[model samples]
Target: MSKVRKVTDKILEAVSIFILGIMTVLVVYQVVTRYVFNSPSSWSEAVVTYGFIWLAMFCGAYVFGKRDHMAMTFILDKFKGKAKVAVEMINEFLILLFAVGVLLVGGYFGALKQMTQADSILPISMGVIYIAIPAAGICMLIYFICNEWDLVQRLKGMKEKEKEEE
Candidate 1:
C-alpha cells in the first residue's frame, strides 16, 4: 500500500509541477503579447484561466493526500489511544462523505450540464474545463480511502493485542 501511495504521490507531484510551469509560461506570454505587442491573445487568457482552475483542483487533492490540510487540532491533541484513533476515523469518514457526495456526484452533474455550453474564447466545450472537478474528487476520495485503510489496520492490530493480553 505504501509503495502504491508513494508512486501515486510522485505522479501527482509531477503533474502538479508540470501544470504550474505551463501556467506560468502562459501568463508570461499573455502579458508580453498584451503589453508589448499591443495585440492581446484571446486564446492565451482562456487557456491560462482553465489551466489555473485545473491546477487548483489538483493541488487541493494533493493537499488532502498529504494530510496537510488545515485542522483545529487543539482538542484533538488531547486525545490518546482509542479516543485519538476514533476521532481520526470520524474525521476521515466525514472527508470521505464530502468527497464522494459533493465533489464526485455534484461535479459530475455540473460538468454534464455544461457539456453543451462552449467557452466564448476557446473552441472546446465548457465540460472540458468542468471535468477537473470530478477528477479532483476522485483523487481526494482515493487518498481518504488509503487513510481509512491504514486506520482500519491499526484498529485490527489493537484488537489483536487486546485479545492476546486477555
Candidate 2:
C-alpha cells in the first residue's frame, strides 16, 4: 500500500513540477512578446491563465497528498492517545466527504455545463479547463484514504506497544 502511495506521490510531484515549468515558460514568453517584440500574444495570455488554473488545482492535490495542508489544530492538539486518533480520523472523514461532495460531484457538473462554451482567446472547450476540479478531487480522495489507513496502523502500533510495556 505504501509502495503504491510512494509511486503516486512521485508521479504527482513530477506533474506539479511540469505544470510549474509550463507556467514559467508561458509567462516568460508572454513578457518577451509584449515588451521585446512589441506585440502581445493574446493566445499566450489565455494559455497562461488556463495553465495557472491547472497548476493551482494539481498542486493543491499534490500538496494534500504530501500532507502539507494548513490546519487550525489548537483543539486537536489537546487530545492524546486514542482520543487523538479518533479526532484525526474524524477530521480525515470530514475532508473525504468534502472532496466527494464538493469537488467530485460539483466539479463534474460544473465542467460538463461548460462543455459547449469556449474561452474567448483559446479555441478549446472550457470543459477541458474545468475538468481539473474533479481530477484534484480524486487525488485528494486517494490521499485521505491513505492517511486514514496510516492512522489506523499507528493506533494499532501504539496499542501493541502499550501491551508490551505492561
Candidate 3:
C-alpha cells in the first residue's frame, strides 16, 4: 500500500512535468518557426492551445495531490473539537463532490467530443483534448481521498493521545 502511494504520486508528478514540457516545446517551436522562419504551420496554434489545456489540468491535479492548494490556514488552525473536524470534513467533501462531478459530466462530455472531430488545423477528435478534464478530476479525487484518510488516521492518533493523557 505504501509503495503504491509513492508510485501514484510520482506518476502524477511525472505527468505534470511531461505536459509542461510539451507545452514549452510547442510554444517555443511555434514562436521560432513563425518569427525566424517567416512562415508558420497552420497547426501550431491549435496544438499549443491543446497542450496548454493539458498542462493546466495535469498541474492542477499534481498540486492538489501535494495539499498545496492556496488556502487561509490561520483561521483553520484555531479550529478544535467537533467543529474543527466537521468544518475540515466539509471542506474536503466539497472538493470531493466537485471531483466527482468532473468525473461524471466531464467524462460523459469528453466521450461525446471523442465522436466529433475538430474542423480546424489539427483535424483530430475533440475527445483527445477534452479527455484531460475528466482524467484530472479523477486524479484529484483519488488524491483527496488519500489525504482525508491520512488526516483521519492522524486525528484518531491525537484522540488516542488525549485519552491517554486524561
Candidate 4:
C-alpha cells in the first residue's frame, strides 16, 4: 500500500508541476502576443484556463492524499485514545461517502452530459475539462481507504495495549 501511495504521490506531483509549467509559459506567451504583436491568442487563453482547472483538481487530490487539507481540528483535539481513533474513522467514512456519491458518480454523469458541448476556442468537448472531477475523486477514494485502514489498525493496537496494562 505504501509503495502504491508513493507512486501515486510522485505521479500527481509530476503532473501538477508539468501543468503549472505549461500554464505559466502560455500566460507569458499570451501577454507577449497581446502587447508586442498587438494580437491576443484566444487559443492560448482557453488552454490556460483549462490547464488551471486541471492543476487545481490534481493538486487538491494530492493534498487530500497527504492529509494536508485544512480542517477545524479543535473539536477533534478533544478526543483521546480509542475514542479519537473511532471518531477519525467516522470522519474518513464520511469523506469516502462524499467522494463516491458526489465526485465519482455525480461528476461522471455531469461530464457525460457535457460531452456534446464544445468549447468556443479549444477543439475539444467540455467533457475533457469535467473529467478532472472524477479523476480527483478516484484519488480521494483511494486515500480515504488507506486512512481508514490505518485508523482501524491503531484502534486495535490501543485495545491490545490497554489489555496488557490491566
> Highest TM-score, which number?
2
Over the stretch 123-156, how does candidate 3's per-residue lDDT look in tens digits? 7888877888888887787787777776787688
What local lDDT does model 4 show for residue 72? Answer: 83
Model 4: per-residue Cα lDDT at residue 135: 93
Error in Å for residue 161 of model 2: 1.3
Please state every model's RMSD to the true fold in angstroms: 1.8, 1.0, 2.2, 1.1
After superposition, candidate 1 runs with Cα above 4 Å error: 157-166
Give TM per candidate.
0.91, 0.96, 0.86, 0.95
| Candidates arranged by TM-score, highest first | 2, 4, 1, 3
TM-score, cand. 4: 0.95
Better of 2 and 3 by lDDT: 2
Candidate 2, residue 141: CA error in Å?
0.9
**lDDT for each candidate structure:** 0.89, 0.89, 0.77, 0.90
Runs with alpha carbons beyond 4 Å of true place in candidate 3: 1-4
lDDT of 4 by residue, 1-166 (tens): 7776788899999999999999999999999999999999999999999999999988988998888999788988999998888888888888888888998999899999999999988889999899999999998888887787778888889889999999
Candidate 4 runs further than 4 Å off = none
Candidate 1 residue 119 Cα shift, in angstroms, is: 0.4
- Alpha carbon lDDT of residue 26, candidate 4? 96
